[model samples]
Target chain A: MISDSIANAPVPAAAPNPKDFAKKKRTNRSAKLKQCKLDARREQWLSQVKNKGSKDESNGFRDSSMHERDGSDRSLENLEMRQRGEENDGSIHHDSDLESPSNSPTSNASSVLGGNHSGTNYTGSSSSSSSSVGCCSGCITEEEEDDGCLDDWEAVADALAADDKQQNPSSDSSPDHEPVARSDSLPELTNRVDSVVQVSKPECAVMVPRAQVNGQAWRPDDAFRPQSLPNLSKQYSFPMNSDRHYGRGAVSWAHKSVISAPSSCPICYEDLDITDSSFLPCLCGFRLCLFCHKRILEDDGRCPGCRKPYDLEPVEGEASLNGGSLTFRLARSCSMITRS
Target chain B: MVDFARVQKELQECNRDVEVSGIKVSPKADKLTHLIGTIPGPLGTPYEGGTFEIDIQLPDGYPFEPPRMQFSTKVWHPNISSQSGAICLDILKDQWSPALTLKTALLSVQALLSAPQPDDPQDAVVAQQYLREYQTFVSTARYWTEAFAKTSSLGVEEKVQKLVEMGFPEALVRSTLEVVGGDENLALEKLCTV
Candidate 1:
């Protein structure tokens, strides 16, 4: 699973040295050198993390503190080693993060690395629940063995563990937080943190430039040239065949109406990328991801987000992109709408 | 075809505030497609203190189309089918909006328990009882909830033993227990009535 995440990490991740860029196409030789170094470091990192988690667990205390320390340690190690691996993917991932709210990192990774598509839907955002996915998830490897937490109850426990790290900040004293099982607000907080971590963690993942990895992947290698990276308008949407990409991860989709306006779709909580058809704006200015739009088009005529009779052709035919149809469609919609 | 990514997010979001919301959704098995949603019976209703479980099957067009939810735990509400557990709620049908998450949908179901819309109901008999004999409706609903919704403290085997010891055939007692949804007291009442 760690390899899966590594593979999914943006291809040109970590800031690559300009020398690597100069020989971008001629990377067959240099790529081998980097791959060797990356595999060595990754193996070392994994062993150390596994060993440390077990050692700490045997001590019968300080599990939370140990895990916190381990998390920071992994991030630091990622920085030191991934500098070579982190090439073009870092900035590109970050840029895409900004432009596309409904990020399908798995799609990008799978598309980049064909046959390595170990697609976990809860990839980036809702991956907060992956504390239960102990097998492949790098962060919670020990969790699977310790309690055998196989249900939603695992989330509650991890949320509590994560909570302790926040509450005391005296990271050394995690013992007090262990037995604390019940909480009133944990479920709510878990998700808020989940979205924030989604934005931030991938940035860390993107940092470690895995040059040789990308040197092998990138089916559309020419399209990835730095110049073409930002111009996503041409791809309007992901190919329908790559439907799995549409299933990357979910965030807290049903946020209270009052909080900050949502950036992702209310339905899937997938990011609303205006450039991609991922952003299916309703006449009412409500947005849905294209997957949801296709489903709605086939099942019902109305937009799930709009709360109005859906004008099917409003997006492509009549309603101008600037949301001109909001008032225009509402004014002339139907007598039934006017009556009720 | 079900947008799994969204369902994953929904499950997390819904389960996150399980304590506060008193609503939970967990995958029935390895597949995220089939799920079990649990909602606490609304306070001040006859169904209070009983936990209701809803079985949710996501259609290929979920979010575009509402998920199919039925009572996994038997519920006695006019809008809910007493025999088959089919729910007659609009949002689950034509009124569904993608904006509504499973959490909200379950909340709406909870609200239905608190205030049954007898005029437009799935169970015509229950609706008629609700409109005609209001007190009888409350008591029957309460009895059904007690018998079917609550997770009984007594084990099924114990309930069977106790019922069998009451000078009733073991087979008859077992069937009565099943008929009354494993409630020992209700099984006794049913056996006595027969």
Candidate 2:
């Protein structure tokens, strides 16, 4: 497009002074030629990157291996499955860290209470000794064993299915249960293989609670249900936790789409965390996130991304979502949770 | 970037007359843009046979604000003060308009040098000399123009010495001179107000 515009521009006639004419011609020709070459190189690089795979990979989500797989003959779904396995391993390690013996304050309290009830005001002296032997070593090994059990994908799937059934018992007997049943019946698809292939369906549900309790939100039922994984995939077509790899076709397309898309956070190179992000709308259909919007507003109440004036009217409910009106919402509950 | 299209159009019209007349005006920028203007000092004056250089600075709000002009070369006249090289002219102040171009402003400054408005004196002493000792003032103005403002190599210290000799106190004169930014008469008036 740029090359066509340059080619279509009319050339000027010769000047009276040959020396001045020569200088002007040299400057104009070099500048236009340099610009054309740069644009061509950019277009070529973009096409090469785009041909590699799904657009999400370029948007800073795919890992190095997934990128290499996309570049090779391997399918995007298979590459996603392998990436999910790696992510599950990481989650397991995180779970173990949280569930370690050193972290079990409840067990230690129970041991102290048991000693106090036994009339051994000797509870004080025995508490220290019992805690070291009966709790520390024993609990550590028991916790390690529990962690090992969680490493199995089948067990994790069963646990999830069980939890789902417990929470939505009515749905278990309904026709809507077929999707869940179908998902569970295929144990081979346990490693998020189906989810990866059926990527367009928004499987991940995020229900941001609107109220706060003592500065922390009451823990939601699905708080631990792997929210980041699906959210990242929807936005970039790759795992959220993976270190970015720039090579894949999908990754490049995602990057171009994002870089070209107006609302993307310049700092994180991710879509603005929509739940918490504020919006500044312009006539150009460019919506800047709160951070970028604020910076530009300070200079002039104009959209930095599009260089157009913005009108910041308060939008109510879901009506604001229409016509690309930027909406702001709190992502996480801000209620305080106190265990009795 | 600057609106190069507008700048190019303006430059073309500006250079047309100068190019035809075999005179040259080159646009250059250092601390500020200085339009180095060369014109044969008009005939029949004491300043005849001497070339003069005028320095002009366009303020940031150009077109809206007037360009500041001062004679880089020294000259003496009833209107051109030898003390601070100040030219008593209305176009440099209230008469300025955005529509006025650099070439026109420079031409006006040249015309002011040829026709001195000594009655509205910036340098009262120079005006007095022009009234009382007309030939002496003209001779001194011509001598200074030949010695100072005529050449790029003329030291600023020599110019300062000539201004001091014109009855301007060294300190008040320096402060006033600096205040007007090398315009001697305005600097003296500003100093006097303090």
Candidate 3:
């Protein structure tokens, strides 16, 4: 029926403004360019890691005794080769790609290369190239130190921060809000060049802007203002109960004593209606009503209240039918009341 | 709730009468929301005179993912499995995007039926037969269409049995002849195998 309805529907006339359409096209193009640059950087970093293994193999004679010391040495070499090959070719082989080798030397390569490439691309100038080369040389000098590895992460983060600074020179005052600032900077950075190119096609020229506006002072709070526009809460409309009033009533006591009064269903966000409520036993004094309890039990049989394993006990009595009218009351516990 | 507004808009843009191998196809719907489609077999193939019927089902995640499609009218093709009507096509899997509509997917399916990809196949026997004996495969597929997929009074199991006498598997021959419930040829293929 829906398909038939769709089949018979009339085509709507095109009435969109040409200017607005052009603006949207431009914005999309810039976003796509930035994405392409990021993808290229990721590929280059992977290639560097692959090159690292080849370099290691060439130096194998110098470290001949080191290879025979551990049985895992051969497997490690194999893994490095596999990682390199998979990176060069986009297709994944087996499940090894999913493993996160966080402490591996390859991880360091990723952070260093990722940071440098993202930094250079973000700053829109070739001046950072000399500094990036210096950073790479510094990585080799400090390769033996654990602190050097930590510095690698910091360097990458700093490079990204520097790029963000170049993009949004007016808002760089606070270091605490750097992450939020970086997120906001992406859209603004893309918006500047959006009108210049057609982004859907991959062959467009990528023009990286040079950082001439670095002298402007930036504060982190300013970054938060633009970034807050796309917050998740603003996107989805949540129903708020305005009519219900919270009070210490008989129903409240029943909820607290029997049905766990303040309990909320995780899925539907409805209060557990007492008549239809089901009790789930747990180590903590918490219980979830029937609907939520059943769904979790079917999934993994883990307690939603504390995430602990529960011993299944048969529930008794008539199924609760509080309907959908009930509202959850949030109240301070007896201990908190006593402390006050 | 499902976004009926967007779904309706997509459905309207889809063109149902797709022509492949000179066969015109139009999907018919039963009162119960199930879909049945008929396509005249193309000339020069073993299925030349056959009117093939297929079933179509729109899963909850339609357009975002490929709709389950299967051939209800059985035919012999290297790419199409004998036991299951599963087709190996890129658009049905990784190449699928939400931008594609039901009509496009079906049109692609019709093209697949006309030109079987024997290299990568769901049924190894069919693929092998297609590779080893190209003429025989074509003749068998055409025979299947005339015997099983004919909408005329002459269309019957006896006619299909005549083709089986020429050395086609009975199960493959029969299931291929039956009309599908939804466009889920893949699921029906698996179902027939079981």
Report the poorest 10 consecutive residues by lDDT, candidate 1 chain A. Answer: A127-136
Q: What is the model-wide C-alpha lDDT for candidate 1?
A: 0.53
- After TM-score superposition, the amount by which residue A139's alpha carbon in candidate 2 deviates from its true location, in angstroms, is 99
From the highest TM-score down, the ranking of the candidates is 1, 3, 2
- Model 3, range B1-194, lDDT digits (tens) per residue? 22233344434334233433333323344321234445565555666666666565555544334556667666677666565566667877756644355555666766777777887887788788789988777777767765566634344566455546656677765665554322223323444465
What local lDDT score does residue B147 receive in model 1, on the 0 to 100 scale? 73
List the RMSD of every prediction in angstroms.
Answer: 34.1, 31.0, 34.5
Candidate 3 regions with alpha-carbon error over 4 angstroms: A1-340, B1-33, B152-194
TM-score of each: 0.42, 0.28, 0.28
Candidate 1, CAPRI quality class derived from DockQ:
acceptable
- Note the Cα lDDT for every prediction shown: 0.53, 0.40, 0.38
1 versus 3: better TM-score goes to: 1
lDDT of 1 at A289: 65
DockQ of each: 0.45, 0.02, 0.01
Question: Runs in model 1 with CA error above 4 Å?
Answer: A1-260, A274-280, A317-340, B152-194
Model 2 Cα lDDT, one tens digit per residue, A31-81: 433543454445434543543542222111111111111111111112223
The candidate that wins on lDDT is: 1
Model 2, chain B only, scores a TM-score of 0.66
